[model samples]
Target: MDFKLTEEQQMLQETAARLVRDAYGFEQREAFCQRETGFSAEFWQQLAELGLTSVPFAEQYGGFAGGGVETLLIMTELGRGLCLEPYLPSVIHAGGLIEQLGSEAQKEALLPRVAAGELQLAVALEEAQSHYQLHDVLTRAEAVEGGWRLNGRKSVVIAGHSAGLILVSARTDGQQHDESGISLFLIDPKSDGVRSRSFPTMDGRKACELYLEDAFVSGAALLGEVGQALPALRYQQGRAVAAQCAEAVGSMEAACTFTLDYLKTRQQFGQVIGKFQALQHRMVDMRIELDQATSMAMLAACVADQPDSVERSRALAAAKFIIVRAARFIADQGIQLHGGIGLTWEYMLSHHAKHLLMVARQFGDDDHHLQAFSALLDVA
Candidate 1:
């Protein structure tokens, strides 16, 4: 596949880079993290105003109907700045699910608002015991008179504290760990029987633990067909994984830049450390990893919007596995090259390193994807 960016894609990348550079200074990012929402509402609105948030949705809902390449462009820029916005959860994950599965009325009521940045959404899929398994849902949703009544706890729900709506997965039919009976429900976070405990992640983003006790959602809240939500959930998650790989690539790029700059200026013995052949070789290794990751990220983006198939799944898993390993290597090497300064909170490289580490853990760690790839290795 061709790797060249089109004229429009280049323009999108430039716009995103410029906006992030102008708005996401280190001090500004720290200030945003101090807020209740853990990100800049103003910057999020700026993304909406600039049409970045609407890149992947249908034009009828005020979106650009752009595809995976567009998402790659935007997410890479966001990763560079380490922007703390909920774009992944609100726009990409939840919005994609709605567009993919919502009824006409549901899409009409939600997508426009989401495209306009009027609504924020979070997804709750991980339980205490689930680890990284998406199908290990223990949350139960029993059919009630007009809708479903849900009861369960969701752990480490990214951006759950500030979401107006949350998409939750629960077992409505089969036993735990069975993929056949899982269902998706859109729930109002402020409704009765729901509670949230908010906290900051190691990388400065906000997250929450959610509890549901008889949480009621209308029948309209069901996304896709009953007991058939697993396929869509897994499919959309692949898209998310691809986008995250792009983000990690951006972060890796930043880390490499920071380390190279440090090596050039920092004196050790009689000369700058960058002059040392050993350090130079290490930097070269980091660059090689970064390039590999960038290629894999692009490959993942190219396939993110394709129809569901074993090939798609295998490609995504491979992308994620390679990217995760690259991220971990870059993060560790960046810190090691920088020494004590890299660990300081005041420095941007430290934050980038932390973000890279977090990226490895999200979606799935390196091992998780390796196993997934192994399982689908013979599909071709």
Candidate 2:
């Protein structure tokens, strides 16, 4: 398998890395976190100018026609900088869904605005009872006189408060746990009978719990088929999991690099900690974990690019399992090896660690992915 990236891909990766290094410093990130939106409009505009917001879409939709590898590169760079932008929710998830499943009219109205940073979207899929089950939707979308009426609650909606639009998942046909009958709807966040309560997440990001009480939407709001959206939704989930693994790899890389640099400079027992054989071994282990996790992330991206669902599921689950374990290990060791300063809010490692831990639970946690991987193998 060829792991080499194209020149265009390399340039995209470099550009994203440079942008984050220059614009997402600790102070800038802190300021963004303090804001209610949890992101900077200026930074988002900068990303749009760089053509990043359009990476995952087709050229017809004003995008670069990029794929999983492109998404992986962008997300890894964003993770390295601890960027709090809603790129994952807006671009990779909701925007990608629209590009894949939206009608011609819907794409014409939405994708361009999303690429221009004029519209941000968040996905409301998770319910309180649905831990890591993608199809466990309790939210209901019933056929009404004009279109559809939504009545249910969605929890932990990423970037929900700031999103101008939301893509909500609801059961339109079958049972709660059934894969069929799940449908997605494009919703106006400020629509009547819709309420959202926003809060800060562990990684200093914003999320919301949405309560929809007989909220109404036109028939045009329905995406894809009414009761056969599971496949498209699963495709989106695969891409999201791959992107997340890439981000975790980036976070682990940063943590390990910071710890290694500190060990080389910080004096302990009148000598640099790097000189201590014991500390050197620990750093080597951290470096190994980082490399392994990076490989797994690449594998995930490649597998996600495959046209086969079984291949995608098995590979993504395996990649995420490795990423979740390595992220926790790398983050914990980074703080422990750095001594007390690593825990201080002033140190970026502390924040990176927090962010990495948060990523573990974003799409699914270690146990979830582990179980998924095992199940896939069993079926195989």
Per-residue alpha-carbon lDDT of candidate 2 for residues 104-124, written as tens digits (9 for 90 to 100): 999999999998888999999
Clashing pairs in 2: none
- TM-score each candidate: 0.99, 0.98
- Minimum summed lDDT over a 10-residue window in model 1 is located at 371-380
Clashes of each: 0, 0
